[model samples]
Target: MVNIANYNDLVVGDRVIEAGNSENFQTGDWRSLIPVIDIDKCIDCFTCWIYCPDDCIIIKDDMIVGIKATHCKGCGICAKACPKKAITMTPEE
Candidate 1:
């Protein structure tokens, strides 16, 4: 027989028993918006990279390069974080 814990048996606090496993899921298809970058307005300050919850910002040589669309949920967090207004969120096609 399998033993399963009921809701009444669960712990009350937010606890992490394991390391983050978000990389195993591709959540981009759930997004309704997509981010577009204007390279000319980008200063490579990494603001987008810093604010991305999904780690979807791509970086190369200490510079912001592009977005990793596969894991990006398009939450618009990166676009809102850009100080230069370099990133824009557009409706997904």
Candidate 2:
């Protein structure tokens, strides 16, 4: 799918990009889960920041919050490091 949840614009203008040679768009192919931040529960622990294997976690003002969902391999390290039980592992729908 073309990320229907986020971007709904399907308009395609003329471009030099070619089709058919691109990777599979099949549903059976497995994909990784990307994290979204819940700022309410974030306590600036920075534990999730240090534990991220891919260094995907985003930090501001010393707070450990969201991970780079696109790059995240769905590793549970961020969820484990969240001392406040803020991070939750969710399947990509």
Candidate 3:
């Protein structure tokens, strides 16, 4: 349904063009793995939030709810930084 023939036509020299805004993009599909949060084991220390490169960890009422999978790249930084081992990286289904 989409056309790729025009892709070459859109290219500019060297520099890459800034496409549409990232908010409209769902990059989670690019990940082969996903982070899973066990809120029960979470100590509410905010460590995960501090280490999450994508800042996809959801926080509310001073508590971490979960991750926003849409922007998460499954880099595992949050999981590694969690002292409570509350976050785990799992294969995406």
**Candidates arranged by TM-score, highest first:** 1, 3, 2
Mark the regions of model 1 whose C-alpha exceeds 4 Å error after superposition: 1-21
Task: Work out candidate 3's RMSD over C-alphas.
Answer: 3.6
Q: Across residues 12-88, which tens digit of lDDT does each residue of candidate 2 receive?
A: 56343657632233322233654555778887767778788766787766665456654566767787777887777
TM-score of each model, paired residue for residue: 0.75, 0.56, 0.74
* Global local distance difference test of model 3: 0.85
What is the C-alpha lDDT profile of model 1 across 3-93, one tens digit per residue? 8768676556755455776677799898888999999999999888888988999989988888899999989999898999999999976
Write the number of the candidate with greater TM-score, choosing between 2 and 3: 3
Better of 1 and 2 by lDDT: 1
Q: List the residue pairs that clash in candidate 1.
A: none
Q: How many clashes would you count in candidate 2?
A: 2
The candidate that achieves the highest lDDT relative to the unseen native structure: 1
lDDT of 3 by residue, 1-93 (tens): 974566566656655477655767677777777889998999899998988877799999999998898889888888899999988899986
The TM-score that candidate 3 achieves is 0.74
Location of the lowest summed lDDT over 10 successive residues in candidate 3: 7-16
